[model samples]
Each structure stands twice: as structure tokens, then as C-alpha cells.
Target: MTGTGFGAFVRRAHDAGKLVVQPRMGMSEPDRMRAGLRATRDARATTVGTITLDSYTRVGDLESAELALLEGVSLNGYPIVSHDLATTAGVVEGLYGAGFPIQVRHGSATPEAIFRALMTAGLDASEGGPVSYCLPYGRIPLSESMANWSRSCELFVRSREAGMDPHLETFGGCMLGQLCPPSMLVAISALEALFFHRHGVRSISASYAQQTNADQDAEAVAALRRLCAELLPGADWHVVVYAYMGVYPVSPQGAYRLLGRAAELAAGSGSERLIVKTVAESVRIPTIEENVGALEYAAEAAARTPVEPADSDSQTYAEAAALVDAVLNMAPDLGTALLLAFRRGYLDIPYCLHPDNGGRSRSYIDSEGRLRWADIGKLPLGGLVDTLGAPAITSGELLESLSYIRRKFDCETTV
Candidate 1:
């Protein structure tokens, strides 16, 4: 815990030309969790370990987590807060190293308690964002989530001063994990990283989930990279692309095919890391073997995918830059600027119903399967939003667009 953090390990692996693959894994039982970590480490690929928390732990229901752990009831993930430090330390003691760093991941909008428990246990890395974790997950007010996260970030920074390299990953790019346009995803990712940096975090990762078209995904990640370079100059940052977080492909072959595309996208876009999905993604919870299988598949795919030259004039870059510039100029600090941007409709998310979110914007898939903004609301896109996409889509068209990828990948009658 007093050693290299997740970001530095990822950067080191990247510098050595290795694509680090990680899984969303956890088990309430300490031995099982340790076994999962060992499996991830022994996978035939460059890898990192994860201790994803259960739903109870995620929503701050620590009592339920404790009861489940004591009653021998299996939880979906590890409950770091409910489990004592000895249990967690034993689970990861010999497993975590420079070559095998671990990150604690929970989908919590309010993570103060979680952060405290992690600090006491000497864990250093985690992921979430105020807007991204709040909107899709629950009814927590956006302002409240922001306040909680601000405090958590501040508390976690103490780890850095205590000789631990604490790092965080922003879940912004994967917001709603679906039909949102690439430019919007890129903007949110950039903004959240800035928020983390303002709260005293120097090591962070900006995430981008794979969407429909490979080229569009490539452009989006490229834009994310450029924004980090320009904005996070003093912060240590990298781009991590997630496998499609929407409706997953049901068929094993389809799932693998989709995951392969994500690996290729990450490689071509100059991203340093990838979050993988297993073949069982469309069905039940994946076993450790399935996760390992997915990791190996993605690694092999990354090995074969060639990195293309960067796109200097990408439309994604232009549109995302416009959004970032508009938001940054709205207020003095990143956090207040973000809150004001949403309140003023300058950084609206499509279809997000959060109280603070200006929900006037909408997105749909174009004929070519690229996500396009159906309506840009009051976002200062400089006419770029108006120039692209079809007229506002019908409700039926929206439903079709939501199911677009699932149908393409899961249909019995294939091309």
C-alpha cells in the first residue's frame, strides 16, 4: 500500500508496450477473493486486480454487508468496509505488487465511508465520479453526490502524503454506458478528471466505453487523450477504454467479437489500458475462469491490432474541445464550473434525469451506426451539433437505436 499506485503501474506497462487488462471481480469470502486475484495475476496477459464491491456496499448499506458476510450469505462482491482490515490484507497481502497492482471499484455516488475504510486497510486506488456515478445509479441528489465526492477525494489524498500513491479513475466517459454521443462522453471524461485534479488527486484515469462504430470510438478516445494532454498537464493521467457497457452480446462468439473490437479500438486510439468483459457478460455472473478467458482474448486481440497514426483534425476533437472550453470558462474551479455548466444547460447529458442535469439534449444512432446528437440543447457546440445527425428521432426510432447493437450481435440470422 505504500508503493506504486494503479496509474503508475499502468503507465509503466504502457511505456514497455504492454496493454494492461483488468476485470470487475469480487467475492464476499476472503479466500475466494484471494483466489480471484491470483487467477487475474496468472492470466496470460498484462493484468491488474480489482475488488469490485457488492450492491449493498455500493449504496452505503454496511449493515447488510456485515450480516451477509457473517451469515455465510454470498454477496456479489467484496465488502471492504464490512470486512476487517486483517481479512482484506490477508486476501491481497502477497498478491499486490508493482507487477500486480489492485484497485477498489464500487458504484457509489457517496464514497466517504468507503474511502475511509480503504485508507485504513492501506488500499490506494479506486474509481468513480460525481456526475457519472450519481445519474445512472440512483436518486441521490447531484449536489449531495458532488459534496460527498469532494470530501472523499480530499481524504484519499492523505494517502499520497502518507507514502502511498493513491490514484482514481473517473467513470464519466461511460456515463449511462449507451447511446450518448462520443463528443459528450469525451467532454464529461475530461471534466471529471479535472474535478479529481482540483480535489488534490494527481494520478487519475479517464474512461471511455466502446460504442457502436470502431472509427467513432477511435476518434472519441483520441479526443480524450488530447484533452488530457492540454488540461491535465501537472496530473498523471491515461485513457482507459471499457468494453461495451450497454446491452452485451448474448452469444459467446458475439461477445468475444465485440471484446476484440474494443481491444482494437484501444490499441488504435493510443489508449494505455482496457476494461474487459467476459463471454458470460450477457447472461449470469462470470466465473474467474471466464474472466481470465476474456483477459487472454483481449490480450491476443491487442497483440494483433496495429496502432494507427493519430488524427489531427477529428470532428470528435473539435466538438469535445468546444464543450470543454465552454465549461472551463464558466467558473474558476472545475467542480463549481461543472455544477454551473449542468445547471445552465451548457453540459447536458442526453436522457439523464438527474435533478441538476439539464435533460434537453438527446442522442440517436445514425444510419452508419455512429451515435449522433439528436438535439444539442444549449451546449455551445458552435453549430457542429446542428450540422450532424438526422432530425430529432421518433420514440420508436429511439427504442430501435437502444437495441441496435444487441440485435446486430445476437441475431440468429447473421451475415
Candidate 2:
């Protein structure tokens, strides 16, 4: 990804008082390590952290060695692990044993396992300070996930009712595979609309890994542009970019201009926050040093840029909202529209309006993979509304479902 706009966004975020925590995931090489080191030096971030694998982990013990080098360098501490109980337990134990106050991140394939891990980690972390578990509640069946979270909240409320410390530290919502192809820019925009309405979440810093080779530069930029277009809907929302894995830089000076394009897209989309990747990331994990350099380069570019808006109309917003309505309406009917979208391979879904009471409830993806909606007689009721609508989940109701979980746990709302 390009870095030109990233530095400026980081400064914007810092000015806005958002805590920037760049957690480096795949530090698989020395050049990558150098990149990350560079990013650290340039960012001057207040906190930094890295994930480590222990000897007993499915990977190996090299994680411990890696953790050692990162100890003094990173201000925040964290461990990333699988959804398994043993793995989560082992990683949490190892991090704590090292004497660093830390947080744990794990996918929620097995909520039971996560619940147990949280219980243990929270108890242990309490001995040091506030222990947190960054839960990607966004992946759950929204209705089911929200309901389960509500139940969990009831449990916490009951804990308080019983005079016990709830102690469950959670950050709700994560856009991991929120949209596939990972390059659907329009899908990203629709997703953002849904995100705000459902979760009431205003900001986040999420990351994704693309599968393009070093030579596939155009393909890479397209994917990124799609992401930028979708996620950066212009001034309405904000995001702090954090992509450190993959090949770290690209060819043609034009490669560097991609981030600038994304910035332009964001400006046009009305997005409020942004932090784009700076280094070429197709080859290896980035080192802090290289990461810093990439950010500097990106920062310099954003310093001299202006965004041009694409033409649209008030009717356009309504049309876009209609498409969203059609997709979200499918929830009650098994997402017939989403199934159609899948069949049609329509890349975008528009957000035309806010449903009367709240955002639409329930989003369904039909067997065909398109979002479905109720029929209003002969006319097809909903779908992607704009120039090239992208795939996304934008029902306000869905957003609220995730918000319910996030608020219950006091977790980070964005990312």
C-alpha cells in the first residue's frame, strides 16, 4: 500500500486524541523488521505492540525470541492466538510470565473458549492492571451475536447484582473478512454506512492482507482503491490504516501515488478519518525502521494534495439508500437480495435512507450470495444504488446489534 497519505492521517488522529496502537502481525523477515523499526521511529507513537508465539504454540518458540527484541521498543503489550482454549491460555500465560502488562486478541469461533480465556486472563491481568480482550464480535451472526452478548451483559449485570467484579474487558467489532475480494471499494463504503448505523461506532483502525504478487501492481492498486472507495466514504467516518505484512514496496513511481488516489477517494467519499499503508507490502513483514520511512514518504505527499468530488445528486443518495434497503430487508427472508448480488457479482450496495425507527433490521445473503429485500409489488425492492455499487452490509439494525455487544464489554469500538 502507498504511504503518502498515511503520515498526515496519523497526525490528524493524534490531533483528535485517538490512541494509536499499531500491532505488527507478520514480522517474518529482517527487511520487514527494518521497515517496522522505521515506522516506529517516524511515528513516535505513544504505544506499540507485537504478537508472539510460544514454544508450545502450533508455530514454535521463536515468538519468545521475537518478543524479547520488541520488549523495550513497544509500549503496549499484546498476544494474538487461535480460538482454541489451550492456545489462548498458553499465549496469555507466556506474555504475563514475561512481566509485561498485555492484552489478548483471538477470533471467536468458539465463544466458550474465549469466555474461559477472558475469565482467566482478566483475573490474572487484574493483579497487574486492567486486563482486556479484543473481541472481533463483528464476525458473529449479528442477531445471534448480539443476543449472546446481551446475555453476557445480563451475566455481568448479575455479577454486579451479586457484588462481583464483571472484569470482562472487550472491544467489539472487527472488519476481518467483512467483505471478500477485499478490494471491493464500493462494498467498503456500504459496509461503513452499515457500521455507523448498526454499531454507532465512529472510528477504527483495521488491517487486511491481500494476495497479489509483486508484479501485479495494477491489480494491487485496484484492490486497494476499491477498499479505499468503499471504506473512505468522504468525511462521514475515519480510519487509521495499519497494514504491515505482505511485500513492502512497489514499482513505478506511480505505485507511490496509489495512496494519494485513495486519499482523493476518501475526500470525495466524505470520510473523516484515514491512515493508509506506506511501504511496499507484497514480499515480507515490515521492520519498524522501514515502516517509519514509508510513513514519512506518505506524509510528505498528503502535505500537498486536494481531492476532487465526483458528481452525484440528492436523488442519488436516495437511490443508494434503496439498494441498501433491499439488501438488509433480506434478513427476515434469508437474504434473497444478497444472494442475487452474489449471482450478479454486483460490487456495490447503496445506503439510500434511514428506515423509520432505526436502520433496517436483519441482513440476509441468499443462496445465490446476493442481499435480498421484500418486494413492493412488481418492482424489485432493493440493491446497489450508485454508479457501481459494492457488496456490503448496511442495515442500521445490524449496526445496533454489534453496538449492543461493544457497549456491554467496553471494548474498542473500531477496527
Candidate 3:
């Protein structure tokens, strides 16, 4: 199936007023991975399948992945690159197509080999960004990542020669998964989508992971949509909301509540898709049944949600727009612009310890439960939002903020 098949499938679901939910599932054994995809496809929701890659494959350690496979050792995820083409193809043979599109989710800063293997397996959609996959996962130099991703995009686009329209999703918005604040997240996600478009990717999805405040997250997704619409004219693009990527709620009730809120956020914000987290997330790798259960639960929650109009005039939009404009103004090329943005601190992720990141930026959860910048660093949002004279976040306060959602939901459940 062509990559555009995935985007088309999602667009159809959204047009029918359905939210397309997907699982982050992968297993080492082909039979197990096939079973997971079958379960995801059969779940009681408008769904898609995901083949998440193993850590060894993610870091390009194919030798180790092959060794694990040969020794019959279990792996955390599917090692697509290490598995033979025919074996991976057989895993998705009859399951993947227009009706059940599958995406390979690999957290790789350098993904050329992964891309090649997936395309060979006839899968066209995948997620990851140069900035997102690089800093959070490892110490790969930002410049090197940019080069790697640029080549990967170009390579992916070649699928069009065989009548396939490959789809790429940006992981930029989920940076650090927690306290980086929404505006920065929105800006980076949009920037990465632009980067993909410039490198010849026509079908793209911009992602936003759920943050602390529901209201704030709603505003962030709206800003992301506006940015993509304005910048990516004539491109096939959509918004995807990821369930909270931080310290998940430990209790089943709390976890389900958090996932429910994420579903509502996706439906209310007019996002086309959602990447779900099962209740088992806080404890361990979820089973196929657990994943299907989460998908069904999220679908039910979303069905009950009414789409709310966005606050276009909100602070989130203004701040995010400012950040995007600042980066685009840096250079004509989006990749170069991103490199320059980080080099000059025009774009900085709060609390990110990567060497290329400008460490001056910091954030704190406000008393109102919203993420706010404590230190804006050299980001060009000086007058848009005020951080001047704000006190630095203390370590104790940071720890509390990191578990803010878990505490809020778990406490509510107990009460």
C-alpha cells in the first residue's frame, strides 16, 4: 500500500466524525507482532497499527538485534531492520492496506535503514523528528541528525515512484514529554513538519502530547493546527495528540481517567488522530488485550465529546506563532533554520540536557495548573509572555510538578 493510504484512511475517519486511535505496540517475534496488529485492527475503535522498534534497532545496533533474535531472547519491541524483509512482510502480509494502515514508530535519530526496511515491507507511515529523536533519545549531534533526517525524507519520498505516498509524523511536540510548556512544543512540531515538507514529504502529521492543563493543551493543539494550515498550503497534513508522556498514573482508575481526558482533548480540539497509552503503561509493557481495551475506552470517551471551537486569540497561539516566525526568518531552508535556531538560542527546549540545546530555558507549573516559562532564555517571545523577574523552579517543586498529573488524577480517584 502507498504511504498516502495512511493519511487518506485518517482523513476519511475524521470526515465521518470519528477519531482515529492508534497503539504503540511491538513484539520481537513475527508471530507475536502479527497478533498485536490483528488485535489493534480488531479493536472497537477507528484504529491504525503501529510497529514500535526495539532499542537496539533504534540506535542502529542491528548486530545486537540479530543476536537477540538468533538466541531466542525477547526484545522490548519489533526489530524491523534486523528481521529479514520477507519475515517482516509476512508479519503484516494480509493485515496492512487501505482499511488497516500501519505505521512503523522508531525512535531513531538516523533512520535511513529503518525507512528502507519498512518500505521494503510495504509500510509507508512512520513518526520521529531530527530534534525530537535526537536530544531525548541520545547524544547524537544535532547537525548530524539533521543531515540524517534530510536524507531519510528524500529516500522516503522515492516511494512515490511506485505510486505510494509516504507519510511522516513529527515527534517534535512531545519533547521531554513533560515540563517544556505547550507553546514551545507547538512551535517545534510545526517547524519539523515544515522541515519535512521542504524535504519533499507531502503527507505529514504534527503531534502534541497532552500536558498538565486540559485547557492549555487544547490551546496548544489549536495553535499547532493554525501554524500548519498557514505554512503547509497544498500539503496533506493533520494533527495527532499523544496521551500524556510523563509519569503515568499507577492506579487503573487514575490511568483510565487520564486516557479519557486525552480522548476528550483530541475530539474537542478537532485533532484527526490520537496515540493512546494503556492503563498498563505506568507498570509495564501492555499486553494486546490491554492495548485493545485502551483503544476501545478512548473511542467511547471521544464519542461522547463535543468538538469545541478553538481560542485563536489565546496566548498560546501568539507565543507559538512568534517562535515559528523567528525560526523561519533565520534561513530560507527549514533544516538550516532549525540548526541556527538552537545555535543562537532562538529555539530552546526547557530542561533538555542535550549539548546542542540552549540550557538557559526553564519552566514551572503555575498555581493555576498551567505550564509557564520561568526562564524564556533567548527565545524571541520576550513581550508576548512575561517571564522577567520570575523565580527559578526549585528541585523539590520540579519533582512535584513532574508528577503533577499523576497526583491530581490518582487523588481524585481515591477521593
Residue 37 displacement in candidate 1 (angstroms): 0.6
Residue pairs whose backbone atoms clash in candidate 1 = none
Task: Quote each prediction's TM-score.
Answer: 0.97, 0.40, 0.99
- Cand. 2 Cα-lDDT: 0.32
What's the distance in Å from true for residue 297, model 3?
0.2
Instruction: Let me know the TM-score candidate 1 reaches against the reference structure.
Output: 0.97
Model 1 lDDT-worst window of ten: 382-391
Candidate 3 lDDT over residue span 1-415, tens digit each: 4544888899999999999999999999999999999999999999999999999999999999999999999999999999998899889988998899999999999899999999888888998999999988999899999999999999999998878889999999999999988999999999999889998998999999999999999999999999999989889999999999999999999999999999999999999999999989988999999999999999999999999947866899999999999999999888899999999999999888999999999998888889999988899988987887766788898888899999998998999
Q: How many clashes show up per model?
A: 0, 85, 1
- What stretches of model 2 exceed 4 Å from their correct place? 1-78, 81-255, 263-270, 278-280, 312-320, 331-415
lDDT of 2 at 241: 31
Regions more than 4 Å wrong, model 3: 1-4
* Candidate 2 lDDT tens digits, 1-415: 0111222334454465433334333332333433433344336443232332222221223356345446533312222222234544444342232112232233332233223434443321110000001112222233443344333333322322332233222221112222112222223334333332232222222222221211121232333333334544542233333232222334323334444443333333333323345444444444455555444444444334443333333332333334444445555432233444323423232221211112222233333323233211122323322212333444664454323322322232121
